[model samples]
Target chain A: MAWTAPMIDEVTCGMEVNMYFPAED
Target chain B: MTGAAPAAEAPPIDGSARPFLPRGVRLKFCEVRKSWFLLAPERALKLDQTGVAVLQAVDGERDFDAITAHLAAAFNAPHDRIAADAGRFLAALIARRMVETA
Candidate 1:
């Protein structure tokens, strides 16, 4: 079997979780 | 003024070193991609078959030498070549704080 060097790719996802807070009066 | 953080030092990799994935890092298969990924906090690195084979051998019990030996036998490749490649790969991960040696 032919062996190749390990390769890595950075993965990006669009979905993200964020906490929302109301503006303080 | 703020400055860029210093680069992390590369970890020493030798035949005697036993490497393992540290906490917060995981090797998982993605169903959507049908590939393996080295998942870290807020980051994911897609790995090919060769990468998967190398990482799978890192069981924390086998040193670098043994790991290379196993890979060589499995792939019918040269021990020296596998040693060099796997060592470099692991070293890169170590520098990124993805893998640790014990």
Candidate 2:
């Protein structure tokens, strides 16, 4: 085992989430 | 004009020397993920199966020859090829300060 540990979770605040849908031509 | 800076000295690694991870570098096996990772202060590196096999052989006791022999036997590959590849891999790590001679 040479590499480091795996990430468990992340916490963030005041962040915006955007969603996009596929548009037909 | 300023003179060019001298090149950093490369860590010594040869068939006769043993290589190990130094103080700043960390090695760990993740039980949940069943994977090995190497961590430095600035970055984390994922090791492939072959990389894991090679690093596991670097116990600071065995020389390159012994390590190569072990790997060749373990994988049923040609000894010379393993020797060359493992030597180069360890040497590169030594250059990066990830592996050190003992």
Error of 2 at B98 (Å): 0.5
Task: Tell me the DockQ of each model, to 2 decimals.
Answer: 0.28, 0.03
> Residue B4 CA error for candidate 2 (Å)?
31
* Candidate 1, B6-67: lDDT as tens digits: 22235447889899999867788867568787877766667777789999999999999999
In candidate 1, stretches whose alpha carbon ends up further than 4 angstroms from where it belongs are: A12-25, B1-12
Model 2 achieves a DockQ score of: 0.03
Query: Each model's TM-score?
Result: 0.79, 0.65
How does residue A8 of candidate 1 score in lDDT? 58
Cα-based lDDT at residue B76, candidate 1: 93
Candidate 1 yields a Cα-based lDDT of: 0.74
lDDT of each: 0.74, 0.60
**Highest DockQ scorer:** 1
The prediction achieving the highest lDDT against the true structure is 1
User: Which 10-residue window in model 2 chain B sums to the lowest lDDT?
Assistant: B1-10
lDDT of 1 at B87: 81
lDDT, residue B65, candidate 1: 94
